[model samples]
Structures are given as C-alpha cells and as structure tokens.
Target: MNSNQQNSDHWLVRPSTIRGLWIGGSILLALTVFLQFFIKIKGYFVVDGWLGFGAVFGFLCCVAMVLVAKGLGRFIKRDDNFYQGGNSDD
Candidate 1:
C-alpha cells in the first residue's frame, strides 16, 4: 500500500495537534499538583507532599525497565534462523 493509505487517520496524527495536547495535558497535571497540597494522602509511606512524585517514579521505573530489558537482550538475543534451521533434532 501507498504511504498515505498506510498511515492512520487519528486526530493527533498532526504535529500541531500533538503539541497542543501535550501543552494541555502539562497544564492540567500542573493544576492537579498545585491542588494536591491542600489535600492529604493517607499513604503508608511518606513523601506524599512531593508534587508529581508518582509521575516521576513511574517515569523512572519505566526507563529503568527499558534499560534492564536492553541489558538482558544482550544475553537473551539469538541469531537469525536460530529456531527455523538450528536445533531441529532437539
């Protein structure tokens, strides 16, 4: 198929739309963090007062996961046709 046909028709496909969405979402998240101080989080652990802690934690966790996956891939990756032609007797 042609490039145009292969592309999706999603609303945020355009750069301007995606930029606007990112700006809007950042504003909304900032507002949420600003409003969080007045409220108390009944968590078993402290650091609840830290604004955007959850977002930071989740982002860091995902980055660490990707790094770990890449490190593991070095050990776990196999050559091409490893399963197709090799080890057929086993």
Candidate 2:
C-alpha cells in the first residue's frame, strides 16, 4: 500500500489503540460506579439504589435486547436465495 493508503487507516483499528481504548473505558466505568458510594442516587425503586445497580441493569437490558433480536431473527429471517429466484412473484 502507498503512504496515503497506510495513513488512511483509522487509529481505532490498531491493536495497541484498541487496548488503550478498552483500558480507558474500563477506568471510566469503574470511576462512575465508585462515585455511587459518595453520591446519593434518588432512585424511585429500592433495588435501583444499590451499588452498581445502573451498570448491572444496563448490561442486563442490553443482553435481553440481543436475545430478543436473535429470537425474532429466527422467525423473520428469509433464505439466502429468497430474492434470487427465476420469477419476480416468487
């Protein structure tokens, strides 16, 4: 590849950069969860006021959404040759 093509690659694609990003993100997430101890959360529900509740809830919700999407995909997905047939109506 030419110099321009080499330089065009995004920084996020690099292994070192990706590792650094993961570390930075983890630190930020930990900091937020740690702050929950000092900051009083005015939660509507008693369970939500617990330590790291928001993070756990958010992670669980994301997993549930992924599972729902996978389940829906099973019934809604079409075959690979669905649009490659001989007739337009088929």
Tens-digit lDDT track of model 1 for 1-90: 566854665767766788999999999878877777887656556774476777678779999999999999998999987868855666
Best by lDDT: 2
- Candidate 2 regions with alpha-carbon error over 4 angstroms: 1-6, 87-90
| Tens-digit lDDT track of model 2 for 42-82 | 88999989999999999999999999999999989999999
lDDT (C-alpha) at residue 66 in model 1: 99
RMSD of each: 3.9, 2.7
TM-score (C-alpha) between model 1 and the true structure:
0.59
Q: How far is candidate 2 from the true structure (C-alpha RMSD, Å)?
A: 2.7
Error of 1 at 88 (Å): 6.1
